[model samples]
Target: MLHSKSILSFVLVLFISGCSSVVLPIDERALINDIKAKYQGEILAPEDLKKGDITTYSFPPVWGFNVRSYFSRDGSFSLDREFYRFKNEDRGSTIFEHFIESEGDIEKTGRQIILKNRIAYRKYDSSSDLNYLSTFKECEFKLGTCTYKSASGKDKKVKTYFENGVWTSEYEGFRNSKLIETKIYHKSGLLIFSSYKGLIRGNTSYSNREAFEANSL
Candidate 1:
């Protein structure tokens, strides 16, 4: 009876361990692809656009915007294409005054409105806690532990030992109350890399890593 109990207990321990978040080293290329897939995509402009000035595309689990504009036979916008302001108060006399610098036409690629007020923005449903701004003012170089709240309000803590602005080692999701996420930044405050590990619906669990390079706009 004692031997049987020991075997059963060992099996139970293994099962529970398998169900938990797993952190592993990642490849650079794989990390970049995941970052682009998760973050690089359509972004909305005129964030404060009124409900009426714009038309919304609504679908379960997704939403997008389409401002009314005139088009030519070639599918290019014509001179008739005009946009309205939120109200009679024109902060300044300008229509799409913001410049969108991209290799291709931003409107066609669905990546319009680059560098709002000079700060780059990426689209990720605004759901993932992996936002670019979220990591700001949180910590700095050297060795220490920092705690943050996950999208689901769970305590996510990351401990890092850094040398020369590089994360050498990390203790991610150190406890049950912790969700694992890691971030690295260049000296310029640009996000360089990130990783997240947590549980999801349908018994799915994953550890995702992302690496970002500064893109000139």
Candidate 2:
């Protein structure tokens, strides 16, 4: 028994709500600089990086794994997969490498350094497989936000933003071209709430002390 005007108004309200939920991309380099500024002294030295480990728990239906990250004195880092095994031990096994500020004009702000370009290479087998390379443009201390060009030359844009104590990062570049977003709400550098959507979906929250306990480092 709704009138025509009432139906039109309802449709308009739904349209506005949909628009509000859309995530707009931001400046890639600016976002990386912001993250580096916030975590200036947290960068790991070569010796200190060897001592720490990062363990991430995947929700049910997804297998979990441990990550051992090694940082070099030259501002480069590589992540090795702890569980992956290969018949030929000599074959490359590194998941990815982040070469920060090693190729171009290095820019320094105080003791902190901002990386302009980074190159990441996936696991390669010299006996058979071709080395997959993804070139990163405008990278910061770590892999915060940047443009990634795949081996095939397709570009994928990534950006992270903070609002109301929650940091959200969106990556738009999978095979299906779906937007994958992750939101992390933290306190005192510990995760309080974390959620993932678009492709992989899960939501988890924790208390301050619980967050610290969850960290394996």
Candidate 3:
């Protein structure tokens, strides 16, 4: 049940994955590793870019890959202006992800993923739309943390972990902050997985500490 756009994406991924000289091979692990090496520090000023810092990084591809940095120094990524935000290269620019520290507190422990569909998935399907000018649906997380859900029927809360610039068990789904019925991943700098909810519809294997691949979902 892949959408037309999703199908096209699949084909493109196949093409890139099949290419031998594509540098990073259309997968998540390589991209995550690249991102981890680049921004893993603290933010000194408004323009300072640090690893884990929520700054925008542009890539040299047609479907440009972008990043919004974060780290343990800044605390966590959130929907607030001072936390995190990101964008994709739909306007012929490589400015894919953007981040900023807001004046709010993140009380959870999962990663905030800013997706191309402009959705933020926290845990349990808590997806929401981005505001475009100041608040988009996509974002990034460094060692950042946020509020998440635990297993409960009426009232339950649990702390997800976002340390070392990666979400240990967070899964990105649609526009809901609720964890999807599907599995998610820190796939790459620009991609994520909806495996847990049966989106990919294939059995996958982990790649590095970030990405994964499956022949069936």
Best by lDDT: 1
Q: For candidate 2, write residues 1-217 as lDDT tens digits.
A: 0001100011111111111232212222233344344535542222322344432212111111222221222323232211111112122222221112323332221221111111223333323333323133332112356766655677766666554334455554444433433332221122222333332122111101001111111
Error of 3 at 194 (Å): 7.6
Candidate with more favorable, higher lDDT: 1 or 3: 1
- TM-score per candidate: 0.31, 0.26, 0.24
Which portions of model 2 show Cα errors greater than 4 Å?
A: 1-82, 85-121, 128-145, 161-168, 173-178, 181-196, 199-217
For model 3, state the Cα shift of residue 185 in Å. 8.2
Select the stronger candidate by TM-score from 2 and 3.
Answer: 2
Estimate the TM-score for candidate 2. Answer: 0.26
Model 3 scores a TM of 0.24
Name model 1 segments beyond 4 Å from true: 1-132, 135-137, 140-142, 146-158, 163-177, 200-217
Candidate 1, TM-score vs. the true structure?
A: 0.31
Residue 193 error for model 1, in Å?
1.6
The local distance difference test score of model 3 is 0.28
Q: State the weakest 10-residue window (summed lDDT) of model 3.
A: 1-10
- Position 168, candidate 1: lDDT: 32
